[model samples]
Structures are given as structure tokens and as C-alpha cells.
Target: MRAGWWSLVATLLTLPLAARGASAQTSGYLDVDGAWVAPWEGAPNHGRALSIAPAIRRDWQRYSLSSEGAATLADPSHYYVQNLVTATRRSREWRRINFESGLLAGGLAYRGEGFRTIGAEKVPIARELFQLQARGRADVALDKWGFSLTATGGENFGGAVRQPWGVEAGMTRELGRVLLYATARADRFREYDTVLVHDVATLDSYALSATGGRAEEYRTVQPLLTMTGGGTVAMGRAELTTEFGVQQGRRMIDPARPRARKAWTELIASLAATYRIAPRILLRIGGGLYPTDYVRQLPQGKFVSVGLRLERGRRQQVDWYLPPDLPAFRIDTLPGGARAVRLRAPRALKVDISADFTDWTPVPMRRLKGGDWEAVLPIAPGTYRVSVRVDGSEWSAPPGLVGVLDEFNGEVGLVVIR
Candidate 1:
């Protein structure tokens, strides 16, 4: 499904300008990505292929728009198009409410031969002769630890028909460096099967199908638990997460047979870990296993899989400017002395400076003296590259404070307070 792709696009598009170094006055970004996959159990031994996708994003405060498409080349080729738009609002403490929708379409072909459809069956030669799908989601977050809910729906418009709708709710809690989350969801799917045939003389072909009608509604309830923790592990900077879940469902078969009604229970477990091998490189590994059994039948399903990924990127710095000096002050503590720095501003200036010291990975900022802000970073006491952005403007510091040139729109100074 394109749910993962759409969700990623929406996250990047709606990220706060303050976090992305964009001014509240304007927002946008360009993203490029590629991937390759090897054969799995159900897939045949076809040479690896490559795929590339590009995305564009634009945001207006709480509203955002984004779109992306990908093309792939292989013995059997495929391509996909997708787009999404979202609007979100965040509370003072950063709780979020979001609404999003998008569309996905694609075609696939195999070894010069084209099959009826992609994702329907395995053929020496297959193609997405026809397919289009639409999906949407709505979700809300409560503080960092609380309850959240999401509703999702989708439809497939193609040679073979498929439509699904579902809703899920989850709760989360944070305990020190570890977090726990649980979720439950229920959904139903309506699917159609198509077939084509050829005969001699006057050859003719048509589609045949079966369906789970309204009376054939299939329902399932899944409850999942995930635990995540991050710290400096033996493999350097690393994080480990584990998830376990259970699903129970009832399946009704058409043409009612002796075993027309089947009830099954499934259990799933997964683990993921990422290690930063170097300043700019990271390695990730993940694996999952599933076991299932029918209540009144024999064991029917079991699956195990693993994957790895390596990534490298360079970090860059940018600048932002702040509004006029709004009643802010700075306090500097030298190895043996301390001094207070003050700036003059109008009486209407309502902003204040803050400082804080914590071991949090994403350190928090604290308000300090007038016009002054400070943070005690959990890093070794050495000169480290630092960048600062003010009031949602581009970053402004070091060599050039190249933002708005108002009296209050620049860096105060970089202090080394032992």
C-alpha cells in the first residue's frame, strides 16, 4: 500500500518551519530517494532493480501540500504516482491533530510478457494492465503520553476490485528513557478476482469473479504492544525497539462449506536496531516473525523475515533572524566569574530568554535572564559546531548574521562558560 509513502511525505511537508529552518513567511522542500529489493519467499529469482522518487512540498503555517512519484526498471518494470495534502494544529505542548488524503496508481510488467494485473498473481510475464486506488486518514495525538486515534479508508479501481475501511486507536506512555505503546484496529475488505481465457476458431475472453458481499463481511481485531529504548550500546550510538502483537479474526467462505466459518488467532514479534558506526554513517537491522493457528483446524500460517539498511549523509548549518529584542537578557558564567548582559528594547517587547541543562538527546531550551537563553548540552566540554535560529527565521550566527537587520535580529554572542 502507499500508506507508508504518503505518511512519510505528509510528515516532511508538515514539519514546523522552526525545525526545518524555514521562515513562517515561506516554506517548501525537495526530496529525492531510491531503493532496491531482493527476492523474498513469494517472489521469483529476478535480478535486483532500482527505483527513484522525487517529491515537492509546500507549507502555510498549519497547512501543507506534497506530491511524489516513482519509476522502476527491472526485467518486469513498474511505476507509481502518489500525492497528498494535510492540515494540522499543535497544542502548546506539541500535541497534534491531523487530516490527510492521497491517491496512488501504478503498472507492472514481467520479462517482456504482460499479465492481467500487478499484485494479483505470479506469472512469468505480468503487468499492471489496469489499477487505481485512493486513500485517506485522520489522526490526533494527546500530549506525549496519552491516547490517540486514526481512521483510514481506501478503494481500488482497476481490472480486479478491492475496497477497505478501518479505524484504530492507541495509547502511549513514557518511562524514563523507555516508551510503551499499544494499539487496536478492526477492518474489512471486499475483493474481486478476474480471469481471461482463449479458444481456437473465433477466440474470445472475459473476466470471472467472486466476492465477499455485505453478508460476507470479514472482521478482525488486532492489539499490539511496542517497547523502545535508546542509549549508547556496544555498537556505539544505538537504539533498540521490540514489538509483540496478537490478532483474532473470523473468516466466512462463500457457498457455505462444512468449515465455512473459520476463526483464527495470530501472534507477531519484531525487533529493530540502528547503530551509528560513524559521525555520518548508520546501519539498521530488523526482523519479524508471525505464527498463526485456526481455532478448530490445523496450523495454517507462519512467516519469518529480516532486512538491513545502510545510510550516510552530511549535516549542514543555516541561519535565522529574530524579531526586535523583546525584553530578553543573557547571563554568562566564566570559569571563575559570572556577568549579566542586557539589551535595550521597547516596553511592548514581550519575549524572554531561557536556558536549561539536560541529558535529553534533543535537548530542551530554558528561559534565562532578560534577552538571554542558555542550554547545558550533554557533550564533552569542547568547541562544537553550533547553529541558532530565532523566532522561526533562517539561522543567523558566526561569520554572517545575514537575516533581517533590525537591532534585535542577530546573535548575542557565543560564550564558553566552564
Candidate 2:
């Protein structure tokens, strides 16, 4: 099962890299960390954990594909989990509002002491789980203030955890050199199998949810509500942020003891700092003192974590990149009122074209003997934006055309045909 999960990830990883030529761009990052969890639930509870997560993404003018995987190893019971996920996102921009949506599918495999079974038999209750998720986000930025909203829903296949849904809204404002923001989120999990959770521990529940567990029938209905306000100070190559907030939530309650049904509330405070050690490297350190009930089914505790991230390709070129030597495309009117579009990649192994006229579908362009790529389309009298893909990379506006930011927060070349 583990091999199959990894094989699926390998396939997803290969799809973006399959395109040949320097124009097919892919970027990603790798993160690894080791941390210790101090026990607050009970005695003999100190444990250490090590985790590695890597993600890669490829894009074409208007569409993008991404895959991520993580492996975690923990001490105390020698527990470990393997997870992989792949997703596609489509985004478009219209005037002041930008919209984006995506679908994600993934699975998780868990193994550890006492995980194989119950008592003398192997139960396999939480051995394997699968999940699917859908999410959407929208953002609007004005001169000084920006607002955004995000929503997500997902389901868990195994009976251990429930389906879950969440929504978040936020607003930010530029205040001189510091940025101030306020945000709120409400996340709720469906009722889950108390029996299985009890056997595996709430830690499993939390970790499983991270792997895509959804809400369902009940042993517990964990719902979280949080409101926070914070300010970020960015200076030179470093940024620091601090936030104070309060959270209210419900935890796993004993149905047999229905009398214990009061809601729990706690104050939340967190501080974080990030430094750019180099153009492609980042160092992050952060900590928070929020009660565990906000997320996991554990006791209230404070924790700190440090991390490093290294990136390349599009991931590292968010700010700038060298433009191609020639215009990405040239439009000429044909004899029968058709438009002849010629792409200017002198050395691309593959090239595809996408535009609103084609409903944003990708169509392969024919390669000419001179190495130029060409496609003919019956374009109507209208304004549209066209993007091209070199190899299987993210979409980008063809060179020489005017550029505009799309709803997905990407800049694509703009075209107006009359």
C-alpha cells in the first residue's frame, strides 16, 4: 500500500517535468524539521518527531498542476506516516476581483506499535485512509486595503475521522512600513469513530485530518472559531509578525457522560519571524501558546518550531525573470477572416495555446520546418487574453503583448482583437 501511494506521487511528479526544453518551467521547495513535544496530557509523554515535506508545481498560461508529499517519523512508539497529494488549479481575473478554485486528492498510510491490531487480532482500523478536497478563494485589493475569502470542504474514507469544512475571511491594510491585518476562521469536523480514535489516540486524529480527513457521523464534533489581529514589519530581508487572538471550540465529549457539554475557550498569542538568508533560501522561526483543543484532542500547551525552505524555478522567480528574446506570438489576418497565430519559440520541444476563445482549453500548435509554432483560429471581434505553454510549464502571456494580472494572481499577456 505504501509503495502504491508513493508510485502515484511519482506519476504526478513526472507529469509536470515531462515537457522538454528550457521553456518548460517547474519550481518547488523541500522542508525538513525535527521537534520535540512536551507532554501536557499525562506522564511519560515526551516525544520527538521528524518530518520532511516537498512540493513542486508546473503551470501553463491559465492552468497549473502541483504535487506534494510528506513523511513523518516519531519516537515513543516508533510511529510513522506517509502522505501524498496532487491537485490542479484554474484561476482568472476580472477587473478588481480575482477568483481561483482547485481540487485535491490524496491518501495516507499509518504504521506504528499497536497499530496493526487490537488485542490478539489485527484490526487495521486506522491503517489506511483516503481523502478528497475542494477549495476556492477570492481576493480584492484596493489602493490601501485588501480583502480575501477562502473556503474548503473534504471527506475521509476510513471510519476513524469525519468529514470537515471550513471558511476564512481576512482584510489587510498597509500602515506605513508595517502591515496590519485581521482574520477569522471557522472549521468544523464531522462526527468520527470514537472507538477507533480512542485506540489510536487524538494525535492520530489530528495527523489524519492533516492528511485529508473529513467530517461524518459522530463520536465527536470538533468545531473551531478564531479571531485574530496582527501586524507585520518587513525590513530589508527580514519580516516579523505578532498576533493576539481568542479561540472557542468543543472537544471530544463522552456521550455516556452527556452532562459535560460546556464549550471551551482560550486566549491565543503567537510570534513569528522570517529571514531571507539568500535569494533562494529562507529561515523561519515561530511559536504559539494556544490550547491543543483548537486543533488536536490534546491538552493546552505552547510550542515553537523552526524551519528552512529552499526554492528554484517559478517558485523563486515570483518577482522577476528574463523575458524571451522574441515575442511569444504574432497575429496576422488571413484571407478568409481567420487569424493566423504564430508562436515564437525557436527551440521548444512542445508548445500549446490557450485563450478565452477556446474556453481556455489547451490545443497543440503545429511546429514549422523553421522551428516556429503556429495555430489558426477564427477569432471574433472581442477583447481577450492569450497565454502559451512551453513544454508543460505554467501559462504565461506571450511576449510583446500588453500584460495584465489574472484572477489567479498571475500576469498574462493581454490581447484585443477587433
The lDDT leader among the candidates is 2
lDDT tens readout by residue for model 1, 94-152: 33656555554433222222232212233332223223444455555554465655565
* lDDT of the structure predicted as candidate 2: 0.64
TM-score of each: 0.45, 0.60
Tens digits of lDDT, candidate 2, 1-418: 4632673466445644533334345677667666554433333544667766767776655566777766666764444444445455546678888887888776666554332211123333235666678989899989678999999888867635557788999999876547889999999886543222323333233222223344233455667898989998865457799999888876444433323445778877889887777655778888776654322222454557688876545432111111234344687789999998887554355678888887889988898764468899989888888888765546777876887767765666778887
| The candidate that achieves the highest TM-score relative to the unseen native structure | 2
**Cand. 1 TM to true fold:** 0.45
Q: Which ten contiguous residues of candidate 1 have the minimum total lDDT?
A: 312-321
What's the CA RMSD for each of the models?
12.9, 12.7
